[model samples]
Target: MELKGIHHVSAITANAAGNFEFYTKTLGMRLIKKTVNQDDVSVYHLFYGDDIGTPGTELTFFELPRAARTHEGNNSISEISLRTASDAALEYWKKRFQEENVEHGEIEIRYNRKALPFRDFEGQRLVLISEENENGESGTPWKKSPVPAEFSILGLGPVYLTVPDLEPTHKVLTDLLGFRREGSYLSKNYGQSEIVVYASGKGGPGTEIHLEERKDLQRERLGRGGVHHVAFRTADQAELQEWIKKIENTNFINSGLVDRYYFKSLYFREPNGILFELATDGPGFTADEDLSQLGESLALPPFLEQRRSEIEGKLKPLETKVKEQ
Candidate 1:
């Protein structure tokens, strides 16, 4: 049994309203779920993806109001990558970012794939990579997105991790998690450091992890715009249980079998202290809301339904009305 590609990446956002506007309006990703953070009922946990919130396509953010900016450094999930359909799409986004005044870099080749690095309003580091010759799961684009379907963000690409030492992290990824070392590339930012490539299920942009060993920087002070965790995809609850057993068998302590309501999960920190989650792909966002009206209103899991009134009272209203093109 092996993990699928990336399940989702959950990051932190300071302003829910601005996050909503940027992701849904500027980036053209559909806000698939409008919900509260289950652990802390007061804050919002917003989910964005393709037309429907597909497993690999999901990008979530936990709103931490008035949080400090991320102190960028090593031992962190450095950058998140979004997949587009082609090199032509890269050109489209380049022009689009210029027109929208979005902070971005010129299109460049990353591990042989054309990539355009950009930042969100929160200074969240994200790169758009062309999936021209890439394989694995390609997420469906929202038909109604302001960005044309041909050039819209498809799904997650390789997640980049910055660590001081790669040995322990490499062991955890290879021996524990079954990711194989594919190859390496010279670091774009740090010329002295080499970025290693590891692929899990089916080797491709979606299934890969680009690890950079950066001993030069301090440990990241995670805050707003920082990635909380990156979850790799598993098949279902049964498969997730097997993974839990495997994780428990190892020396690493883990959050065993967390029932996330939408999908079951197992959370554990790798050797470098970066949070890694193993999550199921089924019982998705559709479990609570209809496909047509997802993210249109506040959604509560069945377990949290009784506290809806209390939850709603705590959250500051951020309009999530569905606007079709």
Candidate 2:
């Protein structure tokens, strides 16, 4: 079965306060969930997205205070491209970045679309792609966002990956994941590397995954200021089960059927060592809190509910609300 699109792209950010300011005030995404990492209760897990934190619109960050820096290399998610409506929207973001003093690159073309690439304070590369024609994926905008409704970001677009060897991971994307190869383009920023673009679902930013082969570079280190994993969307549990068997026959391995409170998940590492997850989108953020109060307080899964006081004591409080500019 064909997957719908991206579930979420999770990453690590060293500076929690800086990330809060940048993602909320500057970028204008809603802080949909404020919780601690399930595996590590001491660390904060912050989720940012469109008004309601839709699956494709999500980008999550695990805060690691004083953690070692990671070296960017192969088998890493180098860039997270988000979707905006039009050329004017992309242009509006360029001016907004400059006004906010966020460092950004010049506008560039990729696969006949205009893109504005920029990096967060912690050096996570990001791009805002123009998806004016793909209106179906355009999400509801935050009314209070510094960015206007028409110009706000839609959702996750191209999750650019750097792989040491393309063949191994390419199979996982195509044969197992059901993404068809779209075409290729040479990206000047990544050592003039030829980027292969694969797509699934209907044509839009969220459906595209871009790969840049970098066999010469070393395996990337997992640390602060780097992508943690890429989660692809599965329509339901039945689809997730079918994928487990498909992955079992291949050289790759997966952690099967993890009940992750909001949604079920299956974690697998592609041949190149990048973590990829197939997640079912259901019982979403609204499961715990009303939509209006999302991210307003620390939300724990049923298992962690009793340890709320202890967990709260260990982690620093995240400033979820932003005063509109």
Candidate 3:
């Protein structure tokens, strides 16, 4: 099946409010949705991204207050990439970070792309880079964000996954999902070997997937600040359905046709234990709210209407405003 690009990335966070502030006020993403975790309805499942929170632009978080601080080892998400338009946008971001007193490392080149590495409120590594893509499409303008329309993120970059073995996981990405081997590298700090894979496209942050080799680290526990899943986008519902058939033909169990409010999703696990999802891009976050006021309040899927009050009550309130001293 032909794929369009990434759909969204879901990560866990210890403090929902803090994560919301960092992504919206600091990183300049629009808080596009406020909802509850489907499985664990007690916590808030907040989403941040471009206006209307288009498929590829979404970065979701699950709030868990009592989860332990996870050590950054080889088996966790090393980093996530976000794409920018040009070198000028990169420079603008550099200056913006400086003015905000957000510590960031020097701009550097990796795999021939320029990237700026930094941490979020919970130390989850993130990078913003200017990688040109020929077929890449720009996201909807979020007028409320401080970032100008010209500099809004195109989409989520490939999520980095650290695994003990590469061959098995690589098989799932390439053989099953049609990703090609782009390059490989070694990291001194984490003492891990790495491989980079690219989907067929003009390569950019969201297009390149990185796999790290950490043969000795223990498996990760899913909690706050952990990644829940990485979703890839298909051209349309027909294309997504074809992928569902392909997955079933391969003898892998898949959660078929689950309605995720905005998009229909199919969920399954790759070989390395990372949850992978295939999601459709139509009827997006804007379906509920006006494009202007998305992410401004709590939005629920129609099926969950009866439980809205209970869900809201269980979630800790989240706000984008800075706290008064």
Candidates in order, TM-scores: namely 0.99, 0.96, 0.89
How many clashes in each candidate? 0, 0, 5
Worst 10 residues of 2 by lDDT: 316-325
Q: What is the per-residue lDDT of model 2 for residues 47-159, given as tens digits with 9 covering 90 to 100?
A: 88899878888899998897787788888898898888899998899988898788899998988889998988877888899986664576779767877899987788989
**How would you encode candidate 1's per-residue C-alpha lDDT over 1-325 as one tens digit per residue?**
9998899999999999999999988989999999999899999999999998888999999999978999999899999999999999999999999999999999998899899999999899999999898766788888778889999998899999999998999999999999999999886667757899999897789888999888789999999999999999999989889999899998888999888898999999998999999999989999988999889899999999999999999999999986656
Runs in model 1 lying further than 4 Å from the true structure: none
The TM-score of predicted model 2 comes to 0.96
Tell me which residue pairs clash in candidate 1.
Answer: none
The 10 consecutive residues of candidate 3 with the worst lDDT sum are 316-325
Alpha-carbon error at 248 in model 2, in Å?
2.7
Model 1, residue 133: displacement in angstroms? 1.2
For residue 314, model 1's alpha carbon misses the true position, in angstroms, by: 1.0
True lDDT of residue 65, candidate 1: 98
Q: What lDDT score belongs to each candidate, Candidate 1 first?
A: 0.92, 0.85, 0.75
lDDT score, candidate 2, position 276: 90
Count of backbone collisions within predicted model 3: 5
